[model samples]
Target: MRVMTKSALRLLAVPLAVLGLLFGTAAPASAHAALVGSDPAQGSVVKTAPAQVRLTFSEGVLLSRDAIRVLGPDGERAETGDANDAGRGNTTAAVALRPGLGNGTYTVAWKAVSADSHPVAGAFTFSIGAPSKTSVALPTQEVGGGAVGTLYDIARYAAYLGFALLIGAAFFIGVCWPDGARTRPMRRLVATGWATMVAATILLLMLRAPYANGGTLGDAFDLGGVRDVLDTRPGAALLSRLLLLAAGAVFIAVLFGSWAKREDPVERQDLAWGLAIGGTVVSVGLAATWAMAEHASVGIQASVAMPVDIVHLLAMAVWLGGLTALLAALWGGHRVERATVRRFSRIAFGAVVTLVVTGVYQSWRQLGSWDALVSTGYGQLLLVKVGLVILLVELAWLSRRWTARLGETAVRGRAAAVAQPVAAGRKGAGGGGGDASERAGQLARQEAALAKERARKERDGDAERTGLRKSVLAEVAVAVVVLAVTTLLTGTQPGRAAEEGAAQQASAPVSEVPEPLDVRIPFDTGGTDGKGEAEVTMDPGGIAENELHLLVTAPDGRAFDVPEVQISFTLKSKKIGPIPVTLGKVDTGHWSAANVQIPVPGEWTIAVTVRTSDIDQVTRTKVVKIGS
Candidate 1:
């Protein structure tokens, strides 16, 4: 068998690329990715001193998020101190209980944007000095809060398994099964696996949210919500995945077509081979979606991440998906074609080598430093994945040795020689000593038949050797399982290990860390074209001061301030709350919203209509959420 032949290596192109992607950067599901579990045990109570309120989640919660807040029994913010995020599995936030938290009720409300951009939230109350937090604990709300994260983990695992298995079945159909073995039973598994993968893809999209704030089933199908999602990165990635899936449907057509024309080797190769590569390319495209959605939006970063992402997807396809192909070749029960075995060996060698080098580079960029490897969940999971990869390499080495043994066996013809000598002995014994001279002559004539038998026996033995090789490939198939399991583990925090590592490195801040804060708009300046912000001071206790800083542009486009302008706040709605609408005298096309006491936190629509000749620039509905 020619090694690295075109046919054998062509299937390899996608797999090599896929392996690169797997080792290159963490997949979307792994590496500080999603929310998994939460703390406070999600509605448990205790009598002991908790020191600080805590929340545990599935994935690392960004330390920059600001949505976790604790409310005291008296309906006051019980912010004794700041919070800290572990950035691994069980993140802890410290909000000191009101120094004298009276023995009563409390609520811990939290909202978070997961690494997948889905919003996860929940409220848990723990009573002080009591064994019970709530007389009525709500379990359903807790589930609804964490459902996105829960479903995400499930979808990822399902996709990976389906990907590896469906491709494996295709390989089996083409390479292994006897001409008669393509039965209804085998067909069912293939169809089911593909269907599962497609279903998971759809489920993942329905679960993925934009900017977190939490999403729901209604949001999943809402026309406006869908539009907002498509406007974001995650949405675009889903669209790309859908396109790739459509391309994979092409594989389905090719697959059945080939099965129907198995006798035509040309047509079989055309359909089977084409579908394998095409389906693989489309399937691997899912990995690239992460880049499009996350890093690629930045200019320079996009250039680097996009190519790297492509390499990453291709490498994964080669390693995980190729495992299926190689395993089938190994087990396919045919007189194992030496050519096929050699082809797989050659491709595997090159792919593993590429994976190691690129993997190191990708790790350097993502993990940042040696400290990261031990101090971050992303780093630890990567280490575990690498360990599994090394184990796979060792398995490959063992299989390669077996391959070489056969290579030597084929060259030496030792089996034929063994049978030839034994058959010659039997024929010699058959000729009797009574007719000694005649016996010698007869044995010579039988030598040709004995030689022929030896060749036939050696050929039969080849079948057995091929079967043994197939078993080795079966062993190789286990690597895919290890990889899929690793994918799920990647999404979880290596919190315990990372914390220990942080302490060991003396990098834990001298001061206890603060709880994460969700930064909003970076508190940017409002419209900086000399549009001065007037000071509108209002006391919730009922008094108000109106100071208008009106800067009006002159006819020549110059600016001047109308120091003395009338400003007042008016009640907009008589129905709900103290909904205030700000009003100001329109002085030469400029207006201001003066004294306003939005006594409540709901929708405050401030109507500012700047009247000008033939034009009224009216910001009549400026809705804002006050106090939150």
Candidate 2:
């Protein structure tokens, strides 16, 4: 009991250290669903309304009945039919447009489930007969941001954690800790894991709607939103997971209790077979639910990828879960058994090999190119995870060495224990003919020496156990980071998706390419007869918030110094009031405003006032087209 308490304290310390590192530099949540290209490409101007709206993603997507919505100038839905999957890999979704759909500008708001069952939603605008002065409001809330998104991600992380604990720990208790089956702590841990998963799944289900629509926390329980989620693949996948968990609970109880604690060999053998088959079926089913809703269910060679993914998840559960069980149950007691430790070492080794093999294949499939490891956010994160895994392997190696040492010590101690009793018996027999007092004295000395030797061996055993405990704790600390990274990785866009998107952008025709919103206007003021050019560049030159760069140059094209620079924006067609923008001077002799808000699509008149001298100031107005 003392050993258990001490080891639990040591185990608790590892995760606490890791939690500090995890939250200190946590990455933002990013979904895997990436927009590839759409018909009437984003921010495009078409002479006529197209027959349909088509959206393509990097991987396959499952759409809700209300998946693709086209809103015309009046903010009325223009889609005529349900959105359907199209193109190869079911990666494209298309919806018919109403005939003669008049548009100043049309917004396409869409919702879909990625191959990995994460729900994604986004909105874009396209125009008919040149860009319109007024367009339907783009869906600013397509993805839940801020608090709701945070909560949704938290739910996902919890689910992953719970699944690992429940599944892995149960496997350990059933396979390696039959003696511990009746322990209260072991049962309670398993129960806690199961309950956590249940709660997390429910939380996720509730958050699905708000996450898809970019709504507030209040919208989490909105019945309509929840209904919408249920209509989608991700929702169904979540539902299936719930069903599996519920069913598996019964078998989990059996495996951890009746089958594990049975004393009858024949009955135990039969129950073992039952548990093996029943548990395997349940595990594979649960894994399939994960695979069906994630990236492995879509993309290249999805058929092969799905099964590989199942294997990967199962391997993770076994390794991580088994480690937890070994630490909390096997090593928690007064004595750490050599046989149990050695058996687990073998099991852990196999799990590691499986993790490596499957991980490599998944990485290749998701990343596609070598440069992606450094080029994409997801790849960089994956690299970090891989580095931590490498560290974990080294820690495992250290722990393995300790296990070997423990095994050696146990063997030598047993031999010494056996030899001591035989030598003491010989001494007692030889002393029968000696003086009573002398015989008694000799026996007392032998007993004292034997007790001292036993104490020394006990101390040595405790020291080895302590060393092993520390190594295991360190390994567990690193595993926590690995799990966090994996959770984040699932939420991030695959590197292959990013590469594919870039290729699509690069392949577009020059005429169709978005023109840089870089404008240079030359002006002359009568006061000093000084001439200068004002060059303005707006990155992501659209009606959306943009970065504005204003550079002033003299007639000689040299950097022209201005006493003050003021910039303001107004939508002429919308008759909106001029919104004053403050600019800061940058080292490059340019005035910059990081976020220039252009609320709606129209001809935005950007008025830049530059004071060359206090008395010789001029304002230059440039009419720039901004799209919603």
Candidate 3:
């Protein structure tokens, strides 16, 4: 037990050291492109019509011809040309607007593929002159949230599962137990994995267009849409995966066919080495198809992250997939050797170390800050995955313990067999037989004793094997949940991107204010000098700080002095507070305040109170629209 603990510590020491090194040098990288800013700005009212609409994203994007759609107030197409990068690189998309656009709100809906090969889309309105009711109708559901998306996500999950099984099972047979390739269960597992991969890849490829465009499932059958998807980066990656699977089919054939059939030890060793090298190459290639197109490829230090991601994926496949294969061997009533189990334990240990190191680096890169771990969806999901991994590791340790017990049982069984033969020989030589009948009786008693001992040893070995099999089965079950969570993680928006996009939106400046708000309120306190009008003006009246000026005048248009004046605002739509405005007397009958803050955009009720005397005061209210 002490030696096992020491060995486990030694195996962990290297990965921990490597993890420390990675953390020291690693930097945060943005994942999932976000719409950072735009030319007109969201919900802004401009006096002059801009020649073209431009959009800027946090990262590079791949634009289709109709990526940017500009709709006029009448729900008519307002854009004159196809969307393009406008020579500002792939991070910006723009489209020219039709000349002489009328004075009303225009809706801009955009859809583009991120540099990481995921689709992103949104819609916002920028009005000309003043805000107006628009005729444009937007989709109620978010992009990629309907039936087609569900099917595509399922296919993605299946592809990951299949890859894990094919690569992991193949590696297990080649390195842990070569004889396993000859077993019906192992062969079925590997073949099923390969077939699943092929089917899932094809489904994803066909559904790519509809998934990106947010179309119906029937759109997946459109030839033109499929061709369009084929021209994109994600489609290319899917195609590459299919091609690699074709090569993998050949590898599988060689593995269970000619390689399994070889009898000579020398030839088999040479062939095994060849298959190992070939299998590794194919596995790396298959993994690259994901690493080069997914979240790792578009972020900072992508060159470094890509290789690490590939290693991470391969390690995951070897551990989880190999566990399934090992379970099959133990439960299928096969005669599993001690050496085979020990070899797999070592391999699984190495795979776990790699997973830990790479997973840490990835989590850091995508999260950027510690707060994001619990605050963001991506981080929360990662936490769940980590918990599952810890459980899996505990189960793995239990399996290792059982493996050690099984080894001890095998050793004891061997010792008993050797001792029984030696004891029989000694007894036969030590005593001379007086008669043939006496000798036969003694031999019969010895035979019965040997049979009973053999049966006891077999029972002990079976008990240990049963314990190991149950532990491995538990690991397999936990591993399935881990994979499911991983698939969801791939689809989620990373925490870093979410935070950055929010910061960008908050910091974005409102470009122009079309008009200021001015209102006149008439009041009477039922006194000779109490009848007057209050002229209130809020300069640059938008969803921001503004200067407010108030002037009290008599019915004859001359300045009138009042004892006190108070003003307040309220937004009934959101049930916001009646925020009071502090005012000081600027001159006779005039009050002014700088930095009057309006919190949000909505129809606000502005109330004014005027006091001509201690006992005479009146309040008046007016509804005003505040722009964002």
Candidate 4:
């Protein structure tokens, strides 16, 4: 008992030490790349056309030649050359525009893989002179969506599941129940885990290109795409995982092969120690492949987060995966010793402690604030996971209770068996059989009764085992959901990044006015010349005095006159008034208003009323952002 306790303590010391080291150096990292700033900024107007458009991200991003696309007002490609890093850093991407571009609004569409390997995309328009009559349409699908995304997500989830199974089941057999390796069911479970890991990793490697590039499912088979992916950090991580898995295969072979066949106690002990050391190295290596390429590798204190994340992954596999192996043992009808179950229970408790400590730290690093926990999607999902984990811990407790009850029942059954044998011996001696035939008959009856008693005890034991099996099965089921949520959490934007972006926008300098608010509203007043469009423009569209212009154009591109035209602005967020603008006719179809005051910076509704005939007037409303 003393030795067992010491061994368990030794096993826990490694992760605990790692956790302590992490606490000293831990810092927050954005899980996904976000656009922090852009040149000719989003929705800004530049007097002259810039040589190139530059985009800046919160973190480093992996870019392809087609990562940035700039379209002219006519929806034609306006970029002169391919997108490049602009010699600034990996965190910036730029594309040169054609020289002497005509005056109109140009749309910029961008897509890039985050340093963490997930894809991100967005679109915005910037005008050279005035807002164009028509702007280029944006693509409906930006980043990860459609069939390719779904398959890639599935592969990611499967890889995590496979890692848990392979590492957990092997650990259970080696440390908890060595004899489990000889059982067909246990051996098959471990082998299945290995196969799953291999297949899922391969699928992920193939799907990485299409998943990041927004390509079709068929692109997964493109060798050229695969080669391109290999050139990136994420691709290299996947390849490293495969190599570690190869080493893992050899470990599995030795685990169920020669190790299971060993009969000498001394030799087996030595081999067990060697296997433990080797297995630890291989498992840590496998976990590092994910840690070094994903969220842990980017942002602040990455060197510490990487090792800490590795421990977290290993702990998760040990708890969830060991539960699976334990279930197989209970249902396999093999005689599982009480000591084996107890050993696993201790290990599971340690794993739970590690999970909680690391989970809290990770939550802090990703969220950075309490309000974000309720406001952000990533934070909300994390709450759901925490609730599920609480439920899982309850189920684990039930399994432990059943294990203890089974142990007590075994002890009572053994005591009853010993007492029964002595009673039979005393009865036979006292009878001293009057004849050889009578004595033989009496002996046969006693043996038959003993057999029946043994069968009754066996039935009771089976009932207890059934209870333990049910609880463990429940744990495994809940674990699957937890893993799925974890995979989704990785793909989501962290709350810290979202909050930072909001603060950045709120604190932007007021002096840097955005582009003018330009919108074209079509209307028909049921009159002969009323079926035209209204072109409205608000220059220097910010919280300051501005000039407003309104032009009424006929369907045939000719100026059309209206008897009366009225325009009003309303700030919905602040519940401000609908301030009216007074316009005077400058020319045939053009009206101008000088020093029109917009008192606030927010999303405002602009309502325009035009009267073609006295009773045939029409009104149209459009929303526009008034920058501070």
Candidate 5:
């Protein structure tokens, strides 16, 4: 017992630890940043599509030399102007758009890199005025049937299924059948699960590079590209899950032969079961974590939302997976004894109940809108799942009713109430003059009828139960499809589809970029020679201020001090006034760090506004870059 416990604790840590690693550390798929919102809202009609396309990032983005192609309805390139950084600000970019284009279906395809190096690529379509072709082609469901989106959904669903099955199988093997006959098969199952999961994982990991670095598939696999997903919580959690899987494999071996060999069958069973349970626990936890990491949980907000949904999702997986497995086991082993069938049927019922209740609660929490059920991809997929579950509920009811009747026949010792009265009446009729032998023969006939009836009912019940169970499996299979779709939907986008379309239609305000306008303002130097030369260097962390030395030579070579020197800068628009601050007295000149900030990037005029008894003059200077 002690040995098994030690083994279970020491070695069983494999799956848990791996789970911890993978879930806490697994990286997000390569080359994809979840779409937060779009510029041209979905289903919006605009008089003009903007010349420049802008996409906002969840984090600050690097200025990448990406090819952005905007195609018009006739499949001609619509954007005649060049794309450049409109200005410098966090998580925002602007494209120079072309004007005077005719009305048509316009598609804007963009590729960009976030400051963290994760690359993102996607396309959105908006129409100019009323489209020549009123029926627009949505990105989804063309003749090709949702090419990219569907493919993504398929891959995600595959990962979700493999992860769930692997975890579930580990749970049963480690916990329920520790010393059972299927040890070899169980080991094989665990091996298959791990391999399936890791291979899928490697594929996902490979995506990060392309999403971050951009270019071809090879680019995504590069170090910088992979680093993008790995550095984030989503990517880290994924990696951790993979590591846990490898460790679990090793721990599975220790649980049986070396660590558990000396123990009795029952003791070994307990040990194995505990280990399986432990593995399952980890897998389930991580599975929930997988979705949690993706769902916008940042900082303290994550603490509440992730844990609640994780528990709810894990509970749903268990109930659904367990029932699916039970159905497969019972359906295949067709002529199951009535009693065993009854026991399993009861279990399936409870599982279904839990699945439905928890599923509803989780859905309500994740999906915030009623309209979303039909509007969003997530909503539609959820509708499909709900429909499938109702079918499952129906099949479960049929199985329950059949199994209950079968249980009646399996009751021991005596006939049931329905048959008891009839049997008693027959015995009473044969009572007074009948010999013991005659009575015994009559009883034998009665017993045979009861036995035959039990046999008939059971056969019928088994067939009925088997059919119902298979239907349940079908429902499960449908659910898997739904789940896969769901996983994909979680990654695609949510909210603001319409808003994006509208913005696209508005199209850069339909105003031409104005020709540069020059304006002049005079500086009152007050006949004094200019004073100081100052330099300051700015970095992300801190600023290094330099001293300015200026020697003023008056016409008569008489040195004079200019008190209260102040410098202020005005933006190009000058809609905002000059930002003025004092320059303190230094060894050479005056300086101050008290007021400092470069609000926006562009050309700005510096004004050296000086104060002296002889003169109050503002010296206007040319534009300068603050932290170029």
Candidate 6:
């Protein structure tokens, strides 16, 4: 007994340690679909205006007719029509551009619904002929920002939880434990799951429009917005999920109806079989809705990927859902039967195996390589998820041990139950041969002894029930965290997207040299030699950290001397620091600063302050592009 207790404690320690590691290492990374690439790529200058603008994403995207906008140098809409899917799989969106807009820069602002139902928005610029200054602004926030996204994420998590509970509990009642149906609480749990799922689906549908368009909270219920959402893939998916849930409810009602009647075993057995088979079919179809609207439907060989993903979701539902069912219905009340626990244990084991197999396939497809696992943000999150699951598996092992103990105790209990009655009967009979009054007294004593044994058995059963409940609760707690991670992961970019982006960068024309920052700033002071040129040089400049060099030339084109030169950089978009850097006088006419870091990706303001004399200086600001 002590050895088993120690083993259980050791098992408990694994998930606790894993939870510590999970929370310690996991961070909230940027979520939303990744931009794979765009035509007339970021910061590219083309000699001719393209007919249409196209953007590709790492996952499938449902493009709204008005999702894409192209603005020309005149700050007017240059796009000719509404955006459309450029390909069949929902990965690309394109909008026509007005031709011959006379050689300037154009900005493309787009909004899209990713396969996982998250809204993403972004903007980039491309130039036709020489680049010209324009007033088109980039999107400040990704769609589904602030409270909307939080609420949406919560809804997603809830939906998953409800699905698991409803499906797992129904499955348990129909197949593993027919007695579970007799309990009102267990039946109510199934109803709660279905209701939760239905509520979440409706919530997601209502929020879909405002989320995708980056509109205000009030926009969630706009009649037009909701109608527009119904036209999209995500909305369709949610509707399908609701319909499936409704059908499932009917099946559950009938299946449990049989148990409620407490009919003959032969009739109940047939009903149970029908429920199991029908339930499996409905669940698979429901799982397909998720696959159709998520990462599973994107990427390579989606035909194969989709099925694997469905299985993965089902496996999760069975394992975690069953754990929740056990905690809620079985151990929470009367002591569960040994056979029920053993059946669930077997089901959990099978589910775990399925999880492993499907998870491996997903990792390979999403991560692509080992380097991605360590380097990419998505990969790092995957590691966190894997860690949590490993711990959950350990917790499962502990619960199985407790189950075995419960089985042994139950067997011992039955043995005592049978043995005590037999012994009492023999004692009464033996006394009967001696005297009639003695026999009556012996029988009375025997009845009291049997009552005492029954009480003892009940006490033992309670103890075992308490032990089992504790194990299950601990397991459920860990499983909830795992589900949270899975939810977060759904909205995050895959490592495959990151790798493709890197590959695109690598394949860019090496022959194309980086443009240098050659700004000639005119400065003036109180002195007669005030009017002069401060020529600044930044080698290999666009977006990279590079050295800064300054050379001062007088109005007469002679070498002009400056007392001190300093530079300040500010990234207004990100509200980054106005980092100040002082230049060292290198020679008669020059000053330089080496290895200056830009820090973030975007346009940065570089201001140069040159002092010609005491209290005599001029500061010049110029915007420069920084690389990602």
In terms of lDDT, the best-performing candidate is 3
Clashes of 4: 0
- Model 4 — which ten-residue stretch has the worst lDDT? 504-513
Per-residue lDDT tens digits for candidate 1, residues 16-59, read: 46645644553222223222333444334445545566655534
Give lDDT tens digits, candidate 4, residues 550-610. 9999999898798988989899888997899989999989999987777757898989898
Better of 4 and 5 by TM-score: 4
CA RMSD of each candidate after superposition? 23.1, 13.9, 10.9, 10.1, 21.6, 12.1
Per-residue lDDT of candidate 3, residues 188-261 (tens digit): 99998999999999999888887877778888899898888878888888889999899899999999998899
What's the ranking of the predictions by TM-score, best on top? 3, 4, 6, 2, 5, 1
lDDT of 5 by residue, 138-254 (tens): 332121023333443454566666665565444433333333223454455556656766776666666544433333544544776667667765577668777777766666665
Q: Summarize candidate 6's per-residue lDDT along 495-580 as a digit string, tens digits.
A: 77676656655554222224667778777766656678888887656443477888889888888677877778899888996998
Error in Å for residue 303 of model 4: 1.1
Minimum summed lDDT over a 10-residue window in model 2 is located at 22-31
lDDT of 2 at 188: 73
TM-score of each: 0.47, 0.66, 0.74, 0.73, 0.49, 0.69
For model 6 the local lDDT of residue 598 reads: 63
Which lDDT tens digits does candidate 2 get at residues 354-432? 7776777677667766677899988899999878876776777777777887745654564566467556756666645
* Candidate 4 residue pairs in clash (backbone atoms < 3 Å): none
C-alpha local distance difference test of each model: 0.50, 0.74, 0.84, 0.81, 0.50, 0.75
Which candidate tops TM-score?
3
Question: What's the distance in Å from true for residue 515, model 4?
Answer: 15
Q: Is candidate 2 or candidate 6 better by TM-score?
A: 6
Task: Tell me the deviation in Å of residue 121 in model 4.
Answer: 0.6
Candidate 3 stretches greater than 4 Å from native = 1-28, 137-142, 408-461, 509-628
Name the better of 3 and 5 by lDDT. Answer: 3
Model 5 scores a C-alpha lDDT of 0.50
